[model samples]
Target: MSIKITGTGSYIPNVITKNADFHQHEFYNIDGSTFPGDNESTIQKFKAITGIKERRYLDDNLNTSEMAIIAAQKAIEASGIDPETLDYIIVAHNYGDVKFNCHQSDTVPSMATRVKHHLRIKNPSCVGYDVLFGCPGWIEGLIQAQAFIRAGMAKKCLVIGAEALSRVVDKHDRDSMIFSDGAGAAVLESSEEKGGILAHESATYAYNEANYIYFGKSNNAEAPQDLRYIKMNGRKIYEFALVNVPKAMKSCLEKSGKSIKDLKKIFIHQANEKMDDAIIKRFYNLHGLDVPEYVTPMTIQELGNSSVATVPTLLDLVINGEIENQELKDGDVMIFASVGAGMNINAVVYQY
Candidate 1:
């Protein structure tokens, strides 16, 4: 069984955050870690060091659910599927509505359950839930949706990767400046087609010590603290991506009986411009193509890092002409890869 992506859509808040924007914000360190900068431009070296330009974000009037709602609506229109016909709607959100309408904390179901009500999804019986994963959440949910579609459990599934990363950013930290808020959606439907998520594979590196790179779990003890803001150890994440991401991409390609040469395009994760640069430099020499030549590197400096939202958002950007020269077309093999804070990395192969 195969799943066809009938439609694709994405959203980034109107608020654009540049290096200057972050510098203007206050810096607070409850743990007493000295924040090392005065203004945004002073940290321009850090951006150059990290290789990011800018990232998009939502201002006061915005939040993750709102972005997700916008993207999902666009995806519904692109998919040509009425919202009411949806059988399952799964959101890959680190924290969509942290500043809830009433409550202090946000739960997966709390926001996901309302997609139908808010969008007036035609079928209220459709199951809508949130799948909690780090940066790799999009691919993971995609695989699950494929299973549901194959088993006849769902006629159509609307999967969204939305993250409100700024809510948790340690503003004073320079390494955290790249995080942002955005949303992306893809509609999966049963298909007899050959392409579209032909092979999906993943790997995890759970180093006992490095696990601290990106680690936050909901205590659910009494009040769920700020578990939604994505965090990371930038240096450690870079190491993990350099070592494991290439191997994971290979593992997925091998599963499909293909190699890097056969791929028309590899849509690697867009967390940073450097990761793709390192991958191409280490893996294969994409002749006549730059490392980021095929990649839609979403600049984290402005939008911040939207965690799981990065890859899919970039994908939609390509489709919508936001990305130059290259756009998504049929028979293109895209490799999805991500390195989250838990020192976790996952790679999957999807052919579109």
Candidate 2:
């Protein structure tokens, strides 16, 4: 049996924040001290590099699980499957339900459990849980769903990646612009059909631990002395993705016995456009093929990096005709890849 993605859905916050908004605000270093710079030039450079012009942010009253419920409901509706029939719900997220401007977050009941409750799923047999794998969490969840289906442990599963990153981002830090709030979900069901998930690969780099995100007081500028926010070594992550992501994608494609020519499009994580382009070019070069920009669709320019939600959201948009110049057909091969905080990287090859 193979795990088929029967439906896809995504929800992005209605509030749009422009990159230029940060220019009016003062930035702070880790130690709560002010940092001075040409704000306009800095923002310009940021946009030139990341290709992020704006992003969505959930209202202060909302949380990650709520966004996930919206996405999950859409996926279930599209799949024409009853919530009661869902065998499992695997929620992929880094931070749990965190309130805006609040440092405390609660993970006790798990985000998946919260989603199941919000969706009014009454079946006690419908197991729910959360997966924490940095940005690869959703794809990793799909991989697990594939295993469950093959092992006869589940017949249907809801895989979701939701993040309220704005809750954790430090407004005074430049990194805040790269984080946003959104959710994406997919309905995976056991199918006798040959085209579904063909192959997948996942791995971590312990040596790059320093590149991961962590909560700590600002070290560069004084931003209230005790304020803790999401922090990471951006340069390290950029370098790591340039080197590791393509290798993982290549490995996944090889494992599926599919060449780059067989792929219709690659739905890679919407982390950084330049980095993603570089990675894809490197992958094609390794195989002696020219880089094809048309095969790689991107949403980062508008959606920013919604962490794990990036790939699934991009996939949903493209498959539903919401994305310009992109479409997926029956039996078309597609690849999904992501890299994030754990220095974790993963890729999945699927038949659409």
Winning candidate number (TM-score)? 2
Give a tens-digit lDDT track for model 2, residues 1-352. 7689998999989999998888886676655566656888878888988899999999888899999999999999989998899999999999999987778887988999999998988999999999999999999999999888889899999999999888888777777888888999999999888889999999988774645667777554534667676887777788888888888999999999987899888889898888888888988887899977579999999899999899889988998899888888898999989988787899999998
TM-scores of the models, in the given order?
0.85, 0.96
TM-score of 2: 0.96
Sliding window of 10 residues with minimal summed lDDT for model 1:
215-224
Report the error of model 2 at residue 277, Å. 1.0
Candidate 1 has an lDDT of 0.69
Candidate number of the best lDDT: 2
Question: lDDT of all predictions, in order shown?
Answer: 0.69, 0.88
lDDT of 1 by residue, 1-352 (tens): 6677888898877776666556665543434344455656556776776566677667767667777888889999999987888888888876557562333346655556766567887666688888776778877778788889888899799988888776765454455677778888889998778787767776556755355454343222222454433446566677767777777776777897775666766666667766657875665543343454554344454555677788778778777878657776788777777766545566667778
